[model samples]
Target: MRMKRYPFSNKALKAMIAATVAFTPIAAFGGGFHADQVEAAEQNLNFTDLESLVAYLQTVRKHLTDEDIQVLNEAQEKADRISAEDYVDRILKAPVSEEGRALFVATIDFITEVNLLEAKKEDIEAFAKEQSPNVEAVFESEGTSITMDQYLTYVANVEQKFLDIIQLTEIEDLSEEKHAIALTRALLSAKDPSENAVITKTILRNINQEEAPGAIKELVQKIDPNLSAAKVVVKALKKANEKPEEPTPPGNGGGGTPGPTPGDTTPTDDGVEVTPVVEANGNEVIGTIPDALIDEIVAVVTPEKDEVVINLPKVEVGQTVSLLIPAELIDKLKAKAPDADITVQGDGVSYEIEVEDVDTAALAKKLGVPVSELSLKVSVNPVPSARALEVTKAVQAKGAKVLSQIVDFSVEAVGGDKSVILRNVGNEYVKRGFGLNANVNTNRATGVRVNDDNTFSAVPTRFVTEDDKQKAVVKSLRSSVYTVIEGNVTFPDVDKGNNWAENYIESLASKYIISGKTNGKYGPDEYMTRAQFAVLLTRALGLPGADYDGRFKDVKGDEWFNVEGALMAAVKNGVVAGKKNGTFAPNDRITRAEATAMIGRALNLSFVDFDKEKFNKNKKITDFKDAKKVGASTREDVLRAYQAGIVAGTTKGNFEPTAFTKRDQMARILAEFLIKADLMSELK
Candidate 1:
């Protein structure tokens, strides 16, 4: 059962599935019946021949169900019995000679071939050989030889034929599988599980009456364990009286057990929690569904705290939304989710949810965690004269190639160089960022930016270049995650250069290292905390296979102190083979000297070529003296990783060995470790 590989290939995994599937039977009837029998019954429903029937049935599998399946079995049994009975009854009634039975089989063969035909025939007799009857014998005996048409037509319509086949079987007839299948289909088509239990019982009754076939009864109970002899009788009565109808209950309908009497409750606008009592087995537990399936469903819907929520209108049938949430929320969200009609993401947090109504936003907000964060942007028709200079500078500073244009506006007041001031103000607005806005008014200098309830903000910067905001709407679509992540390293089409790595490293503050200052922006040059250094070192050494479960008292899921422990684990794993303090100084701005020492430690070098005083401690890592020392001292380790093509300098092929490593630098360093170790290589 165990494979030698750590991660089995797809082909090997499929072989495993196949090997296991041979022994996994369909346990619909408490393992009383084989899967092939049910499958055969399912197969017989659409057969012209065995091959075509199997092929076609597979395609229509989504449409096939327990009721149709049951009916097929019933009809098949009835057909076989009637066929035998008609054959015997006609022979007994007529007292035909031996030659007549052979002739009758030939006629039946002719009819079967004609039915398999691709062409229409006006007279079946044209294709069939008419057997000239025993004229003299016919006069003496009261027997008749019928045509193929008459035989086929009569066989299809007769009732008594159904009884004969039931008598000929040795093994118990598994009409139960068909019954289970058909009724399950009915519930499925109705798109409700509320009626699933009832339908299951009704199927049991139609097949078994006395002592009730244990197999059928077991299947019925498997679906609705509360179903018993009394309940089965009541359901049989209901089935006999009522025509089959699709289940369409309002509160979690179709598949669950049908509610008492008029089986629907109306939805309300008011916020009253509607609790449902789903019964499984004979017990009335607080909630419904088996433990295994419930856990599986919950595992799919747990949600996390930090993900974007898009404001949307309500939902309607056939509408779907791709809502993204954090990985942590999968369980809690699934617990409150509707059981019927909605199809959500398999990942649970970022799932594509199908809503019956467009007003689903209201429901989602109520059922899911509340919105936690918001981002804002402002737009204006044109940059005011005072803001133009700042706008220009921002435009220049943008690391991408951009088409540029400017407008000069005369400002009458404020400074001697009024126009210049207006331009500078516009530049400042660009430094902030903007979009085109139709409602921006040039006449007014002051406008409200933030709304009172913290509901909305106006992005008030603009360009006269974008005279119409609609014109700014681009036709291009954003690329997928695979593409965007690729751009984090690749030189962009705009020739922004490999400088993207710097921006990527800079952006890592949010996901890679630590929290920012109160100003809501990372102080990129500020000294990293000791805890931050541990994290950086961990990243530099390449995050190794972590057995650390965040189980320690100081390393609970949200604890900030986990960083040091995580690094310590990395150290133990030979990922970071260094240590400074028995306790790490979690809040110090590390100097260039310290960074080199740490990198050296990670390389597991017994000695550095020069003394500690060889390179200046205060200089940035970008300094050449430090770079030379690092490039020369740990040459072998650096060469090992570098020649393996895992290590490289930031710019101009120079390893800025003396520069103070920033947050981004830490990530690059760690990425090299990962690449060299042949671990988490995708990070490269």
Candidate 2:
């Protein structure tokens, strides 16, 4: 008989089966067979689920002799003689009742069909390996002490109980209750069952009604009294009847007298007269307000303003004064000020604001250090018309001391649409290798944001040297507390002492501009292929490539470069061109000249003269000794790229245009291009 084809691919079907087997529990074997005796009799084939069984089979298949195969075949024939219903009845030690027989039979048929599918040995092995994590999760949830046989017994008992409940229920169509039960099952089986239990209970309490029907509720209580599916149905009904809250009247606070309006003048207890200034952009400015009167002004100011900017006298050095803006007022300051100037000013003293306390546990986890080893400080600066913020840490660490100082910089209205540049903030100890012992690679310092959930997320950061000082520059879009931490990415093969491109590689890797090989090595000296270079260039430019239509005959959709959309994006952006044969030799090694041409085109560097010959004749672009060796097609591109600081010649003043570009050389070129084009923020 021909096998029935599944809707999904063979690999997908195998994966689905693996996942189900990994999570499913088998029925316990009966007939006076002890667990140990059954295990020995089955030759360790008494697995809890199919995933473990398949894994064991694959492992032993490689070493199985002809005699062993014959023994296994004989055993399989005996197992096959038993019908699915009989096997279930024997393993479960209970016969399926009339009410649940149909469902049980349907499940058995599905399993039989899966067994009939032609799965190769390698396919089963791959599926086992892929689902190993899920299998481990199931065992972990069930507890390590519980053996496969014990788990099977427990599962069988649960199944029998569920079947009994089904036999007792008269309602044939309980679709709504079924959905609620499904949700409850998922929550109970989640990684954190206790936490999910609270969520389920809260949901039920808010939606449960005294007048709602109790039949489904009683059924659900029989399954799990702590969680009821009928509550969800009540929730749906209540939600459908819920009415929207009425909007508050303008200028009125719950039918009370209207509060202080914009432009209102209020006097503090200290007799410091404060006036609220409202701008055309809806920004409220309370100028010349003394620091002592901030609280009074905050209390009287209306919360409807876009943002409240309080101008005060210079804050004393080392004195931290928290802003007293009300929670409602802060909520109103949600509009992003992308174009607003944000700078650290006032000569060692600046306006300070209170932000959420740092999560030391999360920070320690991210930095891979003990909570006791970390210390954090938050600094707030509110400046007018400033586009950049520079918060300097002048404290120097002593010899051999772990410099785990985390400086948090906070700004308002810096939206994701625009990035704020922070300079000279976290590079004090980078040059001295202060964090080497603490697993902090100072050479690879990165920026991170403090998430609302008290977690840290990496932000794009780059390091640059200016005036003999190494500075860590970070760009962020959100107005929140941001800090610089030692980057966790490093390659065993790339060393800073000998490799000229180590900084470039580290910076790019930290920002996800490049990745290492499978062996955790950054093949810096290895030659780069055309497709590889194109992919790196696309990442450097941050281009979002469009859907490809097989523009290059030789580049297939399945190829990594095509799937990555590098070649397609390069072609779309006019940064690369195919050969005369109409094929992009993506796998071919890229020459320095070819790479230079691509970089020049990406930067949009062009001469006024359209003709290359005329442009070359008009300008002496380079003084390289081997300038003539450069191909005529790329000579102008090479010269233009050099002029734009995107590429450099050899030490001997020879442009090795025909040399195959190494991975290190490619990194340097891309880094230079990003810095020169101002695509990335660099400290001056």
CA-lDDT, candidates in order: 0.27, 0.40
- Residue-level lDDT tens digits of model 2 in 86-201: 32232221233332233233333332222222224465445445443433333342233223333223222222222222222223333333322222222212211222222222
Instruction: Provide the lDDT at 546 for model 2.
Output: 53
Candidate 2 wrong stretches, greater than 4 Å? 1-486, 496-500, 605-619, 679-684
lDDT of 1 at 453: 23
Give the runs in model 1 whose Cα sits over 4 Å from its true position.
1-55, 58-499, 502-530, 537-559, 574-583, 591-658, 681-684
Candidate 2: worst-modelled 10 consecutive residues by lDDT: 32-41
Error of 2 at 48 (Å): 62
* Top candidate, metric TM-score: 2
Q: Tell me the tens digit of each residue's lDDT in model 1 across 502-600.
A: 433432331222234565444444445445666655543323224445333333434453533555544454433323333344355554445544554
Give me the displacement of residue 610 in model 1, in angstroms.
26
Q: State the lDDT at 369 in candidate 1.
A: 32
